[model samples]
Target: MSLIKFFVLAQLKVEQFIKETEGASGIEYAIIAAMVAVIIIGFSSSIQNGISAIFTKIQAALPAASS
Candidate 1:
């Protein structure tokens, strides 16, 4: 095709992309998922530490254990 036609088509595609809002929601969902993952990881780390402490305390209560 002609260069003018190519440019016109590109302009139309750019305009359509700019006017579309579908991608915005996807980004928002991605951000929400990232935040949720961060929260889960943060809580899980603390939970793991707490569980480890409980196991250590239980271990200490046992007799004939290594010093």
Candidate 2:
């Protein structure tokens, strides 16, 4: 999508959030969700490599099953 469209959508959401009487919980939830997503994306590569190494080690240690 175009940057303008993205900005418009974001502005609308922000306005709605601001207008709500009980907005603190909603904002807190959004912030927590965003932080969790950032953490997962940051660590995902390391986690993937660790899991790959573990599987490789297990395969090397296991003998081939009889046919």
Candidate 3:
């Protein structure tokens, strides 16, 4: 019947759409990762400076040697 054929065609289209979307998911994740990487890279110098300051403070808090 034509109704059965239409239903089959609709199911096939839905399946194809799902498959295409599945493939796109990887690309979406990769793009998000890349954006995060860029943000980290941009802030790397500030992060490094903060870490360095923390270590310096820690060192300064220690007792001085009697040398």
| Candidate models: Cα lDDT each | 0.93, 0.92, 0.90
lDDT per residue for candidate 1 within 1-67, as digits (tens), equals 9999999999999999999998899999999999999999989988999999999998887764654
Across residues 1-67, which tens digit of lDDT does each residue of candidate 3 receive?
6999999999999988877765688999999999999999999999999999999987887755433
- Total clashing pairs in model 1: 0
Q: In candidate 1, residue 48 scores what lDDT?
A: 96
Give, for candidate 3, the lowest lDDT window spanning 10 residues: 58-67
Among the numbered candidates, top TM-score falls to 3
* Candidate 2 regions with alpha-carbon error over 4 angstroms: 1-21, 64-67
Error of 3 at 32 (Å): 0.4
Candidate 1 lowest-lDDT run of ten: 58-67
Please rank every candidate by TM-score, starting with the best: 3, 2, 1
- Minimum summed lDDT over a 10-residue window in model 2 is located at 58-67
> What lDDT does model 3 reach?
0.90
RMSD of each: 5.5, 12.1, 5.9
Provide TM-scores for the models: 0.57, 0.62, 0.63
Which pairs clash in model 2? none
| Candidate 2 lDDT tens digits, 26-53 | 9899999999999999999999999999
